[model samples]
Target: MKTCRFILSSGLMLFAAAGFSQSDSTGLPGDDFSLQGALALFKRSSSVEEFEKLLNTESSNVNNLDLNNDGQTDYVKVIDKFEGGVHAFILQVPVAENENQDIAVIELEKNGNESAHLQIIGDEDIYGEEVIVEPDGDDAGTAMMMPSSGARYDHGPAAWLTRANTIVVNVWTWPVVRFVYSPSYVVWVSPWHWTRRPVWWRPWRPVSWNVWRPRRAVYARHYVVVKQRRVVGARQVYRPMRSTSAIVRTRYSASVGRYRATRTSTTIQGKNGRKVKVTKTKVRRRR
Candidate 1:
């Protein structure tokens, strides 16, 4: 009886591990474009015009989306909007004769001469949520500090958790971010429309999900996804102009919606020798 029980428990553990591995690796249509890659490219660009050119280049590998279903990668354009020291660069692509879909937006705000915040937000229609990626590294120190009220904390992790609720990544030291905040800097907007694209730009066939999934590791190391928006004012200015491709939007929503519905819960023993209820979410797709 003891041997049989051990075998049953081991098999169940193996089954759960396999499920987790598959869920972690499974790629969705939205996974083709990497926001981390976009943020990294933006850091390297001197201006938004140069950024747009780099985004469309086949070798860049940042953009692998065919939103228009035209059998070629779509050309992404950059439009910079400035208001009250905030610079919001909108990344968009034309999918139809009159419709232009927004892929993402890079928002930057300069608080002082040497302090600034930056964040890149992926469109919900494309990413299935308001996916925001920002540069994070100083949070460990920032979280240890007290609140603006100068309150006292008895616990260290509690203090860390309190200040961590609101994280503002300062990217002023970043070369391109500093350039944008400089007095000599001018707003950059792509000259290319549906009729005009960069002469050097050549769209290529997008790679398979299996090939593209591993490429994210390059940019994933440098950035982190945060729940809060640091540049709210700049993002607010873009509210009226935000748009998404209907074709891609519908497909992404359907694929993501199905996955969200397949959640199940089970009780498992924790390291503390206590039972904890955990929910497992699995994706279901039609063959």
Candidate 2:
């Protein structure tokens, strides 16, 4: 009898080990997912049932994610069979702020053999900012963080979370301007000059003077200035300009003539159609 009992015990141990090895190889059929992979799966799958089929697993428990905060829950879960592991993730469905009841459980595997459970302790509001948490045993968790205060715009990672609550997952919100900088170096060229030059070169040569008069020159300076403007859902904001400057210079032709002019007056203008007053001062001899 003792010998028979030993044999039976040994046989059971082998069977259990084999089963565990098989489970590892197949990856729980449904519970095997990287944290990001699980969130991606949730976004793509329409329903809990669809999610399970896609993930090749079921949920041990699905409930609101508002673990403590009072709000509508926007999270769900899927579980693996052999070890009873849980994967907590969020759904993409739009919900009222603070409402936490949109979540649902897709599958449950509870056998003496393997069992897992997931619970939401608070509201999903924790997602307003990035949140990090440690995983529970074999379970994983994920959450999303909003863009920082005074963020330039709403262009960045839409969501983020960890593979397991214990594992750290990071999501970044990239600035929209990062992808696009306003066109710089605006040149105000004469329409006549632009038409005469090749289309490609027009941007480089903004102003031109008649080639016949080499002394008559035309040039432009480029500089940027900040201006205020309102954007959708935002208050007045400062925007950068690509270029700003005086485009043209006034010209004056002068013939020699004496004129009283102030020291501060640097600009010389032609007077009396025939001659221009080029100002010069003379010292008087006191006798």
Candidate 3:
């Protein structure tokens, strides 16, 4: 009930879920900072204060934002985890809503940790340690700064995006699972990665994760530009909305300074035979 359930294209739906973990993942730092340990602590935390204390200890840095405008910070970030070829991201606030907010549970292999490309976005296999989660979708996908090259790479756990530097694309409001991670810094993750089956600690029946939420702001588009160690531009534009379910896939032609979104949807005929939906998605890539 804590999740803000909005109408998915149409019709408002409500769902709740819960689960917990007392186990830890090996092969990571094997310390409290590891994803598994953080999950263990979040599951058993008796109070919000205690959960945040655990988060502060495990993360190298934290990004604070008032997601609902309540003026109280709702999110605390952690490290990234890879399980069975998918990245399992854990955010603080261990509850039924946050538990189900997770889209995938990853299981990691012992020796393959370093070489694992957690996912192939836009068909490019990106290593797990290099991804970033930009909460604001400000064109700058969450990135890790490589000291050797002085360049940042787009690494957030998003769906349907091109490889690093091709032109970062996200569905703005559509949810894609992501872990708050930094390559050079310590991170906390979820033990959900260890389980192959869905955990049933919820007091009620579980529902689908598709109602699969994206961890960061998934409703807009951003193209971030950083030049000379400074962010020159970061822009977020809303995606085209429709009355029916649709999927928008976008490709950027860097030479043209524009983003073209090809949206596909099915329209239901009303009594008047009116089918309502956005036939096209057009957003100018801000410079």
TM, every model: 0.73, 0.16, 0.23
Best by TM-score: 1
Model 2 regions more than 4 Å off: 1-6, 11-37, 40-89, 92-287
The stretch of ten residues in a row with the least summed lDDT in candidate 3 is 235-244
> How large an RMSD does model 2 have?
37.9
Query: How many clashing pairs per prediction, in order?
Result: 0, 31, 24
For candidate 1, write residues 20-117 as lDDT tens digits: 54565424445767888888788777766677787887777788888877788888888888888888899988887677888889988865545666
Alpha carbon lDDT of each predicted model: 0.71, 0.24, 0.25
Candidate 2 lDDT by residue in tens digits, 1-287: 99999999999999997665443321110111122233334335544445533332223122212222234322232321111222223322222233222121212111111112122111112221111222222223222322344533222233432222222212111121111111331211222211132233211111111211121111001111111111111111101101111110000001011111211223455556454544333421000
Model 1 TM-score on a 0 to 1 scale: 0.73
- Expressed as tens digits, the lDDT of each residue in 90-111 for candidate 3 is 3422222323211112221111
Off by over 4 Å in 1: 1-29, 138-162, 165-168, 259-287
